[model samples]
Target chain A: MPMTRLYVSVLLIAVLLGNNACTHYYYAPNTLQTPFLQEQHDARASLGMISGDEFNGYEVHAAYSPLKHAAVMVNHFQVSSGSGSNVSSSEDSGAGHLTEVALGGYYPVGKYTTFSLFAGWGAGSVSNNFDFDVKADLSFQRRFLQPTVAIRGKWARFGAALRFNQLRYVKGEVDVEVGEPDLTIIRNIERASPLFVPEAGLSCGFGYQAFWADFNLNFCNIRDRDDYHFAYSTVGLSFSCQLDYFWRER
Target chain B: MEKLRIALPLFGLLLLAAACNKKADFNYYYYEPADYALISQHLNLPEIPDDYRAQLPTHIANLGLAARPVEQDKAILGRVLFYDKSLSKDGTISCASCHKQELAFSDNAKVSTGVFNRAGDRNSIALGSVLNFSAYYGTDLFGPSGVPFFWDNRAGTATEQNLASMTNPKEMDMSHSDIVSAVQSKAYYAPLFKMAFGSEQINSERVSDAIAEFVNAIGSYKSKFDKEAEKAIGYNVYSNNEYKSFSGFTAQENAGKNLFLANCASCHSPTQSRPAKMKANNGLDIATTDAGVGGITGVSADQGTFKVPLLRNIEITAPYMHDGRFATLEEVVEHYNSGIQAHPNLSEELRAPGGGPLRLNLSENDKKALVAFLKTLTDTELIADTRFSNPFK
Candidate 1:
């Protein structure tokens, strides 16, 4: 019974992670494409919205099958969010924005499943304004690789993916302008070791005719050189249209 | 039908995620300044002067007393709570009832009277001046090794001390919940609490924090001694040998200062170099009924040991000692002069070379000089500062 309870707990955690919001500042795993090549020249374009506790953003994705067994895909994501506050302005606000781009390939595994891989890079910047004319800014850059697998039925699809990322903090500075002595603190983070981030994702979708909508949930565990680990999660919904389907006769 | 099976679960998950609404984003700006004018008008709070935020002297900082800066809003809120009688069960007593600012924040009574005029066990200790009690007692002085508060040192931080007093049967005679409800019921507390903590959630911890801030801000650095010392040797007079001569003092006052530095400075140095290490059995009695620190520790050597109170404004804080047995500073000085008892656990400083009670055998003039020097330590500014005075008036 205890083992059963443990299994249920794990399943619940997985479901929660799968339904969480997007990674506004961090790398997230790419969603799986179940049938990589439905036809020799199959092409699909998707627009998605990602939402998380820390960020809200959008993603654009395009995939085209050049061969009967292989397909190429490209995606772009942008997210922005804010937190904290500023006392002088009577505004408590700190904001961050992230931009990421990726290109990948997929290979059909069976009649109903496919495997895909992607490599991506992202850049993010955050700024905070505090009381007494104090402002802090931080910039980050990261690279990631993801592998995924998916199974597809006539109207539904289920998939999972894992993303491995390396992150580097580019710059962090704080500028204070109060009273006589103005001070600017530029942190030396160049010597800081890169962080290793491991991410996992779950995706599901249903479609009718030429349009399809899907949900993707990604969870990432980031570990710094000091071995401190932090976890972040993001959830996204994507809408896509198979353009060739409408052009071809039934 | 098949779509419904997958749609319901997914819908439920989305609802759960939205319900969580976890605050994970980094906030860029923080600290919204409260409407101070509104708070002041509602609570009858006085405006804090720029001098109230004065920096500690370099000499005092060199003494290793850690600094705990108090926010102005928090201190103002704390002042209200300090004087509010609603903190007591019967609405008759507050923290300031015993720790009056005029008497260096110590009660003139031997032991302070609590709710229902109940007498406490130990004399109330002075907690005034620019010295940060929380920094001294909670962190720097003896806090690293877990020193407790009060005469017996049963509590730890100022927060713990306030909570203990509030819940003690002999003190405020109110439970933690009762204190919270009382503050919550006061309409004036709403804006003050919101200004201090960014919320109006009246709880015990926030109450303790505000009170501690006010207590920490009751500093007194504008004494005659401070002026004389600063003029003679500048601000960094902690280790200046020239200033040790008491250059600006009168002949008798200088003589008394020299005597104090020679005899009492080991435990009561104004710079706080050699603060009492835990409690010491100050040879108060051969056998004490009040076990003091020993009662809490359950150790034989600790029996009759009590914390050494700071002597910042000792002149007005009389009725001295843990039990407040001595009524006058002369009598208190005379105890060290010739009246030390031969307790087995007598502090080593008061022990004779042959292991009996150490006697000063001082002349009457020397005793008088010592008393005169102690009076110089008084800071009239602290006693008269409207910032530390009751705002209810």
Candidate 2:
């Protein structure tokens, strides 16, 4: 019953935040990964649904502890307004894809507590189309360094994370025919290339033995935000599976 | 494990290659090289003079006229739109067809010929009448100057005014859809649109906005009168009072100017800034035949009242008045001197104390001097500036 309620709540938020028209978000904050690895060969994989102000989609994340006090992670995400839609056919629509890889380390401070840090790089493309032919298509790369704290119990776990990210617009073509504020927004994004974006995340999960339902919410902070038209926050829910066969015997 | 490691790095390289930068590239994805070369040879964006981007003219500044700042890209787009004949049905007319650059942006005819050689009802308004367009029509419909567009002030903003002209049966005779299609069909305009706006999307609002910006960027305040006025008041003094005659003017010109200041400066400002009056019935007829502003408002009091135009560039923009009844400045001056009619809605300024027309029955030389002074209001540079010239070969 509780799981059903959580799914319903996530669906409601996604619907409410979908299809923000005539806006081009330069960056969409992804949920910070805080895998709390405690031993070698411990692994966790998750698939989540994402709800953003201008984009709604899904993401997949996997983390593995290769060595004691050392771990690696990979994340992939795809977002769009609708399936098989472009600006030519729709009043407002867009699609985007990103994948990142990272390596980090963790220290178990207590029986139920762990602290970790991760650094990663990601590449992606984002596009927005409105007013029939006015569109912004951009290929971008993001670099991030994150710090996290986690608490674990037998069947439940919680984590907090802060990720400092810098997004660089690598290249792409933009055709815009809008005026004023919308035009100004595109110019500002171009002017602010290699933009510094910072985000905070809170994640929690409840589960049985090796499977869990995870929920996460992230918020990004940008200066002079009113001049920018983009999603600053994202909420996600995911199903996570864990494998610790190597750590179980140890 | 070795194959996986090789594939992972290769995949990363591929992703990075796919995301390679192409920032600010406006060329078409298919035939970009040929299109870029053609457009480059044909259309060179104007290098707007520093004088235009500099501080407003002293007289205009004194009135605190709210004019839009010159945006280089948008202005270029506007210039292209102003000259493109495709905006009209049958491709026979453009805004420039009537608002010619040579004649101070006013046609030589009594009334301009439009699409299919249709005669328009009113004279083509001179765009160079003020320091700039925003100074004349202002930024909005009910802006600081309260200036509306058209001879009758029927349209509000420059966008509305241009749209009305484009759609008018006797003018461009093109619908909004037709306008978009015409603009979209032109391959050359795509690059210009990308330069002005961030893309090649041709739509009516963007079209009108670009044209308005271009029109607003028109006008040069470097007239002889402007130079003398600045010298008289010095720079940034805000007031042209205390000085009665321009030092640069001849005795006859000064005499004519004094007469103008006393008789005509109220409606057409001496400083050439915002005028004190908007529309007035200068007793054009004993009865309102065309009705003018009254026709739009259905107001009896507004009968025969036409917009009071700035006298700047009056030397070239002849065939004057709303109906272009006066062919020359002499006729215009003579009408004011001896031909004001005793109409019911004749402006109070034109009313004699005896409740009839007032006439400044000046001598012929005085009339000649007045015309000479009016000629000083012309800005020679504006008529021939290449920045405003047609880009088409």
Candidate 3:
């Protein structure tokens, strides 16, 4: 790497290591349904809870399929974690939160046992408030495209996906009010070139009903620069209910 | 049924958000007025009896260098800050880590270690005798001779010197803002700061000033040499060549004292007011890697010159010299005896009649006498003084 890139990588790693709550490693799952030939319109809504070290979150998602081969989806998520304390009081605990909204679509490639491709764009903000009156805010926007393939058996469904993501924008601002004059530090964070992430999971249906629960695990690879890299796995469980309105028979 | 499905998740999310809405209830500026009185008691600061202050020897004052009076409250505050480990970035090192009272406020190690056990380049210098050090250099109580501190003498005053060490990346590894933030975050510092600076607001200047006052207040006059010199007539005189042999000294010690007066008194003056302000190369090495004071001044002629420290507690502050190469007083005396090199910047006092390095040509007996005489300068009372001990329990 060039000297500038090396310096940037060192600084990025230091920042990430210093404020661990800001380094997120999870993204929303895509394409919940297996490919099936149908002429009617269908929509599904899901709510999921995910928990991990330094992270706990809830997500609300809704998807509508206008045609059997195409669907559009929207997801909203809020996550929070404790960043520890620097002061004596229990009230002086440091904490951080992240909120994101994403819009995406998916295309199915087969019937019964099927394959599909999906893409999404997202925007989010992360903020951490520390003891001694220190605060940091980071805003980011990203785009991702992925290819997914799934097989719908009689009782269960299994699927895997690989995503390529590009972070288009990132900005950070830090405020420190401990000293007399107070200070505000701002920086424009450069986005990493691109990242590749792979995810796989299994979903089992309990009964023959529109409502079903599924467990999905996502493996995320995040590299902010040439030398800074972070990887983690996130597991989520969700219950969804689907509704269908027949327009024309297949 | 569809409404319930949408309402359940939203309600759960609302509950989760409510659970996460934790606001810390701490006031950074909270301090009780009563805490001010409790600081000295809790830290066990020694109360300076009026008699102790009055009885302090006037030998330093007799040298035309006025004493820098130390206030009780300011020195107490300084004592706390000096030992507080929070001053460092990692809270693992403090001013006391390298400067221990047992070793005359100097470390026994060849090189002192700082935060993360990182070894510094130069040996730690003793700060215990800085009270007389100021008088020797004819500086104010804060040691601002326009000359610097440390082996390199890079800082102008004691406070500036301390600030440099606190922020040095290899030492405390803290920024100026970091020091202030750490001190302000602690509950104990509020009362101390208010007492020292008339306000609870802590700053770098006040912090350094308090530490400088504390260090400058660490003087020792109860040495064997002081007691013996007090009886000798004209002992307090500052004449260039005036030498009064002490009647109280032993035969061997007096012999060593005479030898020191003839050979070493020019640079390492027996009196408090030393005439030499600039450092000398001392011919420690032919081509010195550590440029000493010359590195700070950027003068090639000043290369290898280092500020000679006062030898008030020479016995306890062993592993002597800037790099701590001499492990014993005997080795130190041997260095000046036959080990002086022909460096271009060697002090003229250490040169022979032919203009090369002077070989003292002392026998083993004379070398022993000089070592014994140097031990007489040790101030046993200063090392065990509770006033300079660590305030923290």
Candidate 4:
């Protein structure tokens, strides 16, 4: 774990990604251990990138395990991809980026192989959307040969995600006059969502990487979240590497 | 930033749990006393001047220990609650609107007027001697072992009495939450509530206690018959011309008394000096607007058993009996002498001896005497007693 390389890697995504690097799992109460299983903790982070002006954005995440195979995390995201180039490039303002606090949990399955299924659920409010919902993200990740100083840059990932958002409202049902009777009702609506949101894609990168990273270009279904039946798929790259100072060999 | 946000919400949860616990405490604190003493406390507790125990002694001994210890503040708060108009839907009428003190704690007229000027179905009973009717023989007249109050005897105790009349559609029609809010918001009610409940917040139980306290305080009896009984009744010699010149009297009032005793006293004993409390089918010529006490208890035996009222103010509070059909005292007495209607459950005491209708051989003179005695039972001190006057005034 080299300080110069980790800093350089972080800076590279922040500056070159054009307002698209995101941080995750900071606000959620990720379980640091599995109560019933051996108190083993698991955490993860991911980054991606791609070539020239096709699509843009980046995401970084972290998690804690407190129960068997489950983790909670808080996340930050900045996505610049859009379905239509006309709407994507012309009307593009930085308003779509969001910073949110959520309570999320996930399960890791299949311990024998390097391959594992990733599934997670969470609820939280995004600064951009006043409403909220139950959200889910699923992915498949695998590390080929264990990273030694020599075989460090070996990894592959495949994943799909489905998320729901909610919106709420309120009304008054009591009279406001004298101690006399009031007759009113308050109405509330919470988290508006488009059911069946889907994100399916994969990434393969090479590197016996220590201060190393990879890029993933995935496809997302906009119609999975709303009624207008919009489609938003992206091809982009992300890079992730171990941070210095916190890096140590046991 | 994530750490700060998470900690803040956890704090909010702790506060919410504490608030919920306080609310639950209130629910648990009420309704549980080691020994049941409140029932008796509420039954005989009074707030006025005394020397007037009347049948209360016998009634209390009969009441004998089936009560819980209601707090003292409960009584004071209850009196104010009983008088406050906020108990009505329109906030226009309180319990006092119908249980006016001058009318022996009863609302006069055939039916009481309620919220929105709606008239009730039957005559309201005098709350005065209501506690006295808490028991019958050895058991309560209301439940399997309780007593009854009101002309219809619908409610069991002063508590039920306070409640039924308050919620009757034509009466107060108050909701519990609304009534609590009303009582809590009044300027003087806060301290009153705190004094009674150790807290100013009003709930249904406290509200019931306050009203019950007021009812408990409003007892009746301190009349001539009562005073006459303390010593030797024959000792207190009568010298008034009304009784002295009894032979020369012409007003049928003199005849009404003798006629009343001979024909009406079988059930209405000389002790009460009123007609019997039996639900006798009076020989009336037409159908009644009310089925009398029978309407409440649903018993065929009670078909016409209107409570034998104390006959305290027969003149001022006119339109007598459960229904206001009789209009005047003359009509009520005349019904007994000749107008009993034919009903299967009519009282045997009402049956004229020797088999036919219990017709009184009252001439016009006798009818007048009976009316006279009925009027004599109307004690002047009671009608004008200032203690029972409108508390608001």
| All DockQ scores | 0.04, 0.07, 0.01, 0.01
Residue-level lDDT tens digits of model 3 in A87-194: 333222233333332223344445545555545555665554544334544554545554566655444556566655544325544442222221212221322322
TM-score of chain B of each: 0.84, 0.86, 0.84, 0.68
lDDT per model vs. reference = 0.66, 0.77, 0.61, 0.44
Question: How would you encode candidate 2's per-residue C-alpha lDDT over B206-318 as one tens digit per residue?
Answer: 99989988887887688898888878764432224643677798988877787787788878876777566878998889988888889999999998898888888889988
DockQ of 2: 0.07
Instruction: Rank candidates, TM-score, best first.
Output: 2, 1, 3, 4
- Winning candidate number (TM-score): 2
* Model 2 RMSD, rounded to 1 decimal: 9.7
**Chain A TM-score per candidate?**
0.67, 0.87, 0.64, 0.41
Judge candidate 3 at residue B91 and give its lDDT: 94
Q: Candidate 1 lDDT, tens digit per residue, B298-372? A: 999888999876577888988899999999999999999999998888988888899999899889999999998
Worst 10 residues of 1 chain A by lDDT: A177-186
**Interface RMSD to the true structure, each candidate:** 13.0, 7.8, 13.0, 17.1
Clashes of each: 23, 3, 2, 84
| Candidate 1 lDDT by residue in tens digits, A80-172 | 444343334533334455555444456676788877665556666555444434455566665666678877777987878887766555665
Interface RMSD of 2: 7.8
Ten-residue stretch with the least lDDT total in model 2 chain B: B22-31
Candidate 2 on A80-157: residue-level lDDT in tens? 764326556757677788899876667789799989877778889877665556566777787777889998888899
TM-scores for all predictions: 0.55, 0.57, 0.53, 0.45
Q: In terms of lDDT, which candidate is stronger, 3 or 4?
A: 3
The digit string of per-residue lDDT tens for model 4 on B108-227 reads 668888999999887666555332332241123334344455666565566667777777779998777777777666655665576567676777667876777555545444543344
- TM-score comparison, 3 vs 4, better candidate: 3
